[model samples]
Target: MTGPPNSPTLLREMSERIRALGELPQTSEARAEVEAALGSKWWGLRVLAIAVIGAWRDKAWLVERALRAENGMAGGRFGHARTQSWRDLEAQTAAKAAVPMLDPADAGWLLDRWFSDEPLAFAFYEYVGLRLDPTAVERRVAEEFARRRSQQRRLPLFRLLRLRRGVADRDARLRRLAQGGDETALLARDLLSMEARFRDRQAQTPGGAKRAKVSAGAARRAAAAEALAESRRRAGRKGRR
Candidate 1:
């Protein structure tokens, strides 16, 4: 059946229902209500229902359903028909639902897909990275980074991926590229400046100062560990030679 007509009243009712569900624990009745909402003619209400269901349930099937709905509604060539806000909502809901169900292999596969389809939605890759265990996803991450580095012109998305990988400061090649005037360089500079500002502010506060010191120490340890690992890798390569 069709939902209530498009009007402020309809939106308000949907919003109220969502807010009410947010306050209560999930139940069979709540799931039924969400399912009913999904049948609504109003796209907004349908999106809301999908998001609520995905967040409330641990079922991987539900998450996949949400992902399919989002892709059909707001992705690909026909995606231009939807409002930007609607598209954003679809991406957010699908990402939230898909992340937990993703495995390291799935993450790698998705990353490969993203590289093949450069213009694909950012939320897909962003959410996968967010949920990824860095160590587990290390191989794919390194492969993607290497591929991006080989390209002559650095894309904004490439810079974003590097930022997400937390290697903006550690990767000397990327740091060198940041000196050149380009979109990636601008973004890299902005991120570095923001980090500097955060550190400065932390130093000004008593508790923050202590936390900052601890953070610095942790960073040094992490750097040392990384260096040691790289040394071992180099030694292994030499022995193989």
Candidate 2:
């Protein structure tokens, strides 16, 4: 089907409808309006429709519709493909945002799609990990971790490891890596340290907490920079020696 008209009037009307949807209860009729909006030819309108529906009702069917709508976009060339990837990422993000309302089985289905190596699937997997039961996906996570780690390009593996570490509270492993002077681990450590200090300050000064929090954040950034510089200096000295 031909897409909706890319006109200011259509944009204004959709915006008004979305705003109205926010005011009303999430009912089947309201959801149908959102589904109609998803059928718009304009990518931006489709994105807005997904956002509105995902925000209002966290239904799996709506999530699936958003994914399908994104996939319907035609990619004509390299540049078009890149734009399609971005749009797909947006829709995947919207779908993942509704994970809290998804059943465990549906969440697992989403997780399995990550294995397909489709565009934006990894990003969706990351979001799904935050909500799904860790035990249910442990085996898949381990396999993914090993597969990514075996590759020479290790950034993706590191990210997966970091997420797993955070979810599992693998503090000892993080501490060991920090001690071994891994830059990312050190950064994580610095952030955690700053957070603890910030919490303490907030507890001590509930009235001026906003200013204290800002100061604490600035201090954390400065300290992180100094720590990174020190590490570089140490590496340089060791190299020279």
Poorest lDDT segment (10 consecutive residues) of candidate 1: 150-159
Candidate 2 lDDT, 1-241, residue by residue in tens: 2336776776877767766786677888888887787677666666677677767766766566645545555333335766676566556757655655767667556655645433433345556546556555545554554565322212322333334324235334334444545444454465455445655666587565666555643544444455456555766898899
Clashing pairs in 2: 3-41, 4-41
- List the candidates' TM-scores in order: 0.48, 0.48
- 35-99, model 1: which lDDT tens digit per residue? 78777766677677766766665546554554555555545634565554565565567566666
Question: What local lDDT score does residue 41 receive in model 1, on the 0 to 100 scale?
Answer: 66
Candidate 1 ranges with C-alpha deviation above 4 Å: 1-7, 59-62, 73-81, 97-124, 127-131, 141-163, 167-241
